[model samples]
Target: MRLNYILSDLGIGLKRNLTMTIAVVVTIWVSLSLFGAALLAREQVDLMKGNWYDKIQISIFLCTKDSGGRGCTGTEVTTEQKNRIKQVIEANPDTAPEGVFGESKKEAFEQFKKLYKDSPIVSTVTEDQMQESFRVKLKDPQRYQNLVSAVSGLPGVDTVQDLRQFLDPLFEALNKLQWGAVAAAGLLLVAALMQISNTIRLAAYARRREIGIMRLVGASNFYIQLPFLLEAILAALIGAAFACGTVWLGWYLFVKRQAEATFQVWQWVGPTEVFQATGVMVAVGLVLATIPTFVTTRKYLKV
Candidate 1:
């Protein structure tokens, strides 16, 4: 009998503030979805770096006589200097590491032409204009700065450039985007919480006369508080469900399907991970809802 009354009261309270309840659910759904996307993006970025960073090499360009001050002065790299550089690299097993390169200038130029076949400007350039470069793979990519310092001052060395330097700005931009998403999600979550609290407070005020009568009749505090708490739980659970559905649908359509079609570099979170994250969000929302409802009822319903 008590359970039935609680359920009936919860149903009526929800019906009375249907619009507010819907608003709270939508807000929670948006917040959780944004948070999930941000987390997934960060994970993908880390995964890509781990998988691809080691394969990248530092290109050390040698000076050539015809090469203008675009860093490579036209002083052709001498055979002795080339051998000395190669010897130094070979001696340092820790830094030079292991990787194959174009065996001769002809092979290097051919490869370069092939790479830039679509560019008309590159097609017009001749072999003499091309500068020789030593492609050095590192044992540990993280120690690339050490290799750069060691090679930068050598006689024939024109420039020593790491691939990571070019990619750093891109990763920094992604980090900023992730933080922005998190901030937006936080604001939305606060809005959802306030909306839920206000809805419950109004429900309690509407039942003040009945609560006073119940107090006079010596009803227990637990019995008086149960219905309001249950109402809040129901609202939060609904919001969580909505959030989970939105995340799943968005991932399926946007990240999994659309991203693969447009940007092959994008790696999506799998369904299993998405479901697990959604379950956590549901649990968090339920807890946030319960705490506010419990506090409001304790102060207002003095049964």
Candidate 2:
């Protein structure tokens, strides 16, 4: 009998403020969708970092006749100088085990030709013009600057280039994008909460006479508030369902279809990440609905 009354009252309240109920549902849906996207963005960034950071190589180029650097001379670097440079590269504590990879001028020229096979410059370049290099892999790519400085300006060394320099700007931009999404989602979440509070307060106001009568007849506060709580919970569940769907579609089209398909340099977020973000969205939506409804009912339903 109590459940029947509560359900009937819930239907009445929902019908009375149908407009506000829809608004609450739409607001929660948009906010939670943004929140879920922000989570996926964070996961994507972390995934890229893990996939690419280990493969970072610092290129140490030796002098050639055409080289121009502080350490470079007009003549080509000698074999002894090259051997000495290799020893220094291997001796570094940050150097990964068996990570010193030497590329001879012939090998470098071959790679250069393949890279620029379509360009006329490939014909002008010769093996003697190509500089020998050490492709040094480090245990910690973030400390590449230290290794670069240690090898810079050594005899026969022309230049040291860390791949992270090329990649830093890309990562920095992605971090900014992630934080921007989080900020936008946070503001929308607050708006959704405010809308929920307003809905609950308005419902309680409309039922002021009934609430007062219930209180006077020794009806418990739980009985009166149960219907309102259920209304909010039901709306929240609907909004969360829509938000989860939106998140899944976005991830499928953007990450799975486009990013993972086009880019092979890094791993992209998949269904696992989508599931995690959607779970959080549902949990947050329920809490947002319940807490505000409780507070509004307690405050407004008091005779």
Candidate 3:
């Protein structure tokens, strides 16, 4: 009997504020979807760092004489220096690193020219003009600084460059975007909570007469308040369900499908995470909805 009454009250409350209920559902859905996307992006960044960063290496270019009096400065790297660098790399297991070295000056030149094939300046350059470089792959890419510091002032070494420096800006931009999504979701969540509070308060006002009658009949405060609280919780649960659905659909359509097609190497968040996130959103909505309903009914039920 008590459950029936609670359900009845919940149905009537939802009917009375149907527009506001829809608004709450939509708001929560959009907010959680954006939040989920941001989380997935963060996850992808971490995945890339773990799986791809170690594979990237630092390249040390050897100096050679060129048009100007650049001793081993501007010209092609000599055969002796190439052999010496190879020997030093193979000998020093600590710093030489274990990546394939481009032994012939022609090989390094070909790679450089191929990389800049579209450039007009590169079209005029020949293999003899390019310097040989040691492509050093490290056991741990994070230790790139150690290798760079060690090789910078060494003989025949012109420049030491880490691949991470080139990718830093992209990761920084992604970080900023993640924070922006979080801030936007937070603001929308606050708005949804406020709307839920207002709707529950209005429902209480509309039922004041019935509540007065209950109090006059010697009904317990708990009996009078339970139905209203249940009503609010029911609404919250419905909203949370909608939010979860939105997140799942958005992830499937936008991140997983689109990103996989565009960037084969990138990883996306899976359904399990979406379900977990939805469960959290539902819990939050339930608490937010129930607290205000309980507080508002206290004075009304007492009368």
Candidate 4:
């Protein structure tokens, strides 16, 4: 019976302020959607890092006839210079347990051919043009600077390249995008909260006379506040539901279907990540609705 009365009042409050309720719902939808996208973006970046970072190695390029390396001398690297670089890398504690693998000029040439086979310049390059280098795998890829700093000044060492350097900019950009989404979402959330507060205030004001009669009849504050709280929860819930749908659809269309298809070499976030984001959005939506309504009703409900 009490539940039915609360439900009835909830319906009345919702009908009485339909426009404001719709506004709150739309605000929650946009805010929660952005928030969920930000969460999914974070998960996507992590997935990419875990997939790519582990396999990346530091390549210490030796001087070639072209002299393209930063610290390289005019002449090609000698066998002794190569051996010395190998020894230094093997001796580093951060280097992976296995000995450093040296790629010969011929092997480098072959790889370059395979890589640039479709490019016009592949025919112009020769084996002698390739730089002999040591591929040093690290126990921790983040310790790349340790190896690079150690080898950068060594004789015949032209340039030390961490494959991570190629990836860092992309990851940083993605991180910035994630934070940007989060910032935008945060502002929208504030707007939603204010909208909810105003909705509750107006509902309370419209029902002030009834609230006074209820107060005179000895109705509790909780009973008086229940309908308004329910209204907020209902609007937020609808908004969260829509937000979850959009987030999932966005991931499925853009991330899973499009991105994963195009970038088969790298791992991407999938349904599991979307589900996690939706779960958070739903919780956030419920909280976003309840707190402001609770606060506003306590002050304005009159009962």
Task: Compose the digit string of candidate 2's lDDT tens values, residues 1-303.
Answer: 887899899999999989999999999999999999999999999988887888999999999888898787788899888988888889889999999999998999999999999999998878888889999999998778778888899989999998788778998999999999999999999998999999999999988889999998889888888899999999999999999999999888877889756847678898888999999999999999999988999975566
Which residue pairs clash within candidate 1? 64-74, 64-75, 65-74, 65-75, 65-76, 66-74
Best by TM-score: 2
lDDT of 4 at 191: 94
Candidate 1 or 2, higher TM-score?
2
Q: How does candidate 1 fare on TM-score?
A: 0.87
Query: Which residues of candidate 1, in runs, are more than 4 Å off?
Result: 68-73, 91-96, 99-103, 212-222, 259-267
Q: List the residue pairs that clash in candidate 2.
A: none
lDDT-wise, the better of 3 and 4 is 4
Ranking by lDDT: 2, 4, 1, 3
Best by lDDT: 2
Better of 1 and 3 by lDDT: 1
What local lDDT score does residue 297 receive in model 2, on the 0 to 100 scale? Answer: 90
For each candidate, the alpha-carbon lDDT, in order, equals 0.75, 0.90, 0.73, 0.88
- All predictions: root-mean-square deviation over Cα? 2.8, 1.5, 3.6, 1.7
lDDT by residue (238-287, candidate 4, tens digit) is 99999999998898888778874674877888878888889999999999
Residue 114, candidate 1: C-alpha displacement in angstroms? 2.5
Model 4 has an lDDT value of 0.88
What digit string (tens of lDDT, one per residue) describes model 3 on residues 260-297?
Answer: 67956645667776766677767777776777777777
